[model samples]
Target: MTIPPGPYSPNPAPLLARALRALRRDTGLPVAFGGPVSRDGRGFVIEQLDGARTTSLLRLRVQAGAGLGGRALALARPWVVDDYFAAEEITHVYDHAVAPEHLRSIAAAPVVVDGAPRAVLYVASRSSVDFGDRLLESVARVVQLVERDLAVEEEGRRRLAAAPPALHSAEVHELVAELSQIAATVQDEGIRRRLVDVCRRTRLLAGRVPSADRSPAPAVAAVRLSPREREVLAEVARGCTNDEVAEALGLLPNTVKSYLKSAMRKLGATNRVQAVNLARAAGALD
Candidate 1:
């Protein structure tokens, strides 16, 4: 569950991909696709489709209160039509688009984040069978998972946007990627989202402010330092003594000294100050 980043890489909007793949798990539905609600809340644009019958759905616009997705967004809950052409629970604004795709039965649920609709997810079957509670629950689970991912990502963006100029050089992408990975596996949406927020803020401060070895330790040559060692060294580089480093890294004084010692040994340094100097010279910390 601790998917700490091995290296920094951008976490492209994962909501689209994670939502689509999660919906695709229900083999009963041969065609599935979904997208994020626009920030303006006027509509949503489809970004991912799996086994889609027609590309017409690509970037298709679903106006609020109009189609299945729109209706779900408007209601802020899951909405399904046993037959898209006959169902009275929602509007039929997308018939032209739906017909080309030959979609008979369809279901939709809003991807709610922090109590507002962020996106809409949809699944369809070509046959006449009605989508039941079991299938609906699957869609809900996917939406919840994606919501958690977005919440964490939003925190990362906010942190990066607010970061100091000098600290901006440290990568936010890797820290966000690490949070995204861990959030993806968490089953509880609330817990996952909260965890992601903490991860983003915590990593941002650690990366930007500098630490002993540096919690997000980067690799150089083959002389690797454990994450703890890197963090310990980063604090030392920041001029924090053992007690200060221990408090900052959430370790005891002796533990902080131990990690620093380990890092120093790995860096071929005889002391804490020498280890930090060597790490900086090797581009392991900045």
Candidate 2:
């Protein structure tokens, strides 16, 4: 599949500002800010101040796998440093970037998709304590939310491309509604563009098809699974059994089986294996 180009322009500044605000609200850390950084590309830069005096800090460039943030991006996981100067795994690639900011304690988490790091979220504190798992979890939650929005936008594009040429008027309307909803909920500029692209394509498709004035047919609603159902389906796609899903999700075997059944029904699949395949086709497992 062709990866959609990054949408970094339209709402990135506002999104960065919101991310900074969320970091502050979630962590209460002295310096709660993060932005997308690219080794070969520009990164998002955001900052929040807690004091009356606002100070301008030096700008720093980060390379992948170098500093704390780079390491997080490289590993596609979260990393923390209690004392930046004392960390043994420290890569000096971004040391220059942190020096001017007077960064000490730092934590970073990768915003990942398809097992690749697309961006990094970082939080730094002047205090001595390491940024704990609680803070990391908060950052991860935000990243996951962003990734989900991205995924939905991608799916919308694929669906539009594959839509039947003879789609009924009601089908066209439903597709437009889905496109609008996804666009509204998606935060990433890149994903939003993909959603719009799908909308545009669907409009083009609609124009090519003859319009009918009869009562509209019921549109098929795209299935939305709960987080647990999503997780279970993901695991099932990986060849996990009910017992394995139970262990992974910390649920009873019966509960895992139940989730699988419900997921299958929602996906309109006859069995677990079929559900996994259908889910993947629907881009739920992308």
lDDT of 1 by residue, 9-109 (tens): 12323545656766877536777787767666767877678888579888788888998888888888888888899888777778877888888888888
Please name the candidate that would achieve the greatest lDDT relative to the true structure: 1
- How do the residues 113-141 of candidate 2 rate in per-residue lDDT, one tens digit apiece? 45544455666776686456787777777
The residue pairs that clash in candidate 2, if any, are: 7-190, 36-44
Tell me the TM-score of model 1: 0.59
After TM-score superposition, the amount by which residue 65's alpha carbon in candidate 1 deviates from its true location, in angstroms, is 0.5
Give all candidate RMSDs, comma-separated. 11.4, 11.1
Model-by-model lDDT, in order?
0.67, 0.61
Worst 10 residues of 1 by lDDT: 1-10
Q: Which candidate is the best by TM-score?
A: 1
